[model samples]
Target: MKKILAALVVLVTIGTGSYSYAASAEKAFARVEKSGTIRCGYFTWQPAFMKDPNTGTLSGINYDFMDKVGHFLGLKIEWAEEVGIGSVTEALGAGRIDVMCASMWPDPAKMFHTEYTLPTYFSAVYAIVRGSDKRFDGNLNSINKPEVKVCGIEGDITANASRAAFPQANFVGLPPTADGSQLILSVVSNKCDVMLGDAPLLIDYSKTAPGKIRKVAGVDPVHVFGEHLLVNKGEHHLKMMLDTAITTLVNSGEMDKVLDGYEGVYGAPEKAFKPLR
Candidate 1:
């Protein structure tokens, strides 16, 4: 009788554990459906996600895309919080936000903690240097030397790319909170000799600081990364829903229209590239 009681208790505990695991797996999607709102954690990157300081109005390619996505799903998108690029995964894992509406580069490191929806677009990464500097002009190999100083936002794609491409170069990593301007400043001040970034970001900065920086000419892009919306890992339902909505927008040309509206005004088509159909 004692053995039977112990066996029954063990089975009940195992069953309860399995039930809890299943509940946790669907928790994120269930919460969003129950609330009818998808809370967003966004990072502020120009032309991608931007916040108007005085009015607190949010506008940009990702902002518009997400708005349309919410409409398609019949759900409200709440701009719940602004997250730093480095800690975006942590924010998602903590349940502070339902999804990261901001378009992010899906690198291997980030894949560990997050699941990404279908890519909305692509961006080419370039090596940027001072405008007057010509050491690496035609010789891409010059920048890979140990003496070259590469600066990029800590934990960002550009920094990771640089480290991968130029193993011998010295890496100067800025805080995750550092912005494009800060990275540009690092190059301008000669704190770093080279920096890696997307063309749109470099062009935008060039507008403000003319003749300060220029991309290395006559070389292929360092890398091309697909930009994706991020959700916490294991939120398969949420990811599937988002992927469906994105495919609808892309196929119907609505996504292109959104990108067109921001072109020249916020760097699209020229700086950002649309995904190939």
Candidate 2:
């Protein structure tokens, strides 16, 4: 009886140790600390986010925020693959990256797979059509037709919302290949009849490309949502670290300074971003 009891105790100890090892290994934040790198996943969008294709350099409100975050964690920010809206959930779920560098909005579908740090900003989502195309002039409902080819960034909140708004339209997604500024490119190039994206971004885009695309006057968002960065599921440690960094920036007014600069440069509306509560 003594020998049997001893063996059971040994088994229990081994099991407990194994669980501790597995849990530590599964933690994304611990891995980040060991590696000293945060693999950040991002996609191509411009005005005030991601990289500029012409210069092949990173800039924008998102970039500034990540820079501050990297400074706080003492981790080098390594740009990972440019992930699209369509596959961000899969990429994060597979542990392909440590963090999502670009901002994401809330969606029930996405919430099922991953988790978010606190929201960073609120951007107005809008509908854009080629300036010469009067087909959707001021009529949001008219856009929901089979002939209209609507394109949006795959995995984007706008993509999901656009589908809800224009269910009958032949909506297509810009694959990851078109990840950078391509959704807007599609509308301006006439590859699609409409592009649904951030209002300020599209407005800024219209200025650069001149008379190519224009927002439909008074087109309301399909719904309201806030932009946020993402962390792998149950990565509470990583989530807390990022949330702290962002909240620090907000409290210090540094984030607003960066946003103010971008808003001036990108023509973002005054009400587009508000300080976190």
Q: RMSDs, each prediction?
A: 8.2, 8.1
lDDT of candidate 1 over 136-249, digit per residue (tens): 987778898889999877766767877888989999998887767788889999999998777767767778888899999888888778888989998866786788789999
Model 1, residue 135: C-alpha shift (Å): 1.7
Q: Tell me, by TM-score, which candidate is best.
A: 1
Off by over 4 Å in 2: 1-25, 52-55, 269-277
The alpha-carbon deviation from the true structure for residue 108 of candidate 2, after best TM-score superposition, in angstroms, is 2.8
- Could you tell me the lDDT of residue 127 within candidate 2? 79
**Candidate 2 lDDT, tens digit per residue, 71-110?**
7656788887777666888888788888888887786667
Candidate 2 — which pairs collide?
A: 85-154, 85-155, 86-154, 86-155
Best prediction by lDDT = 1
Report, for every candidate in turn, its global Cα lDDT versus the true structure. Answer: 0.80, 0.72
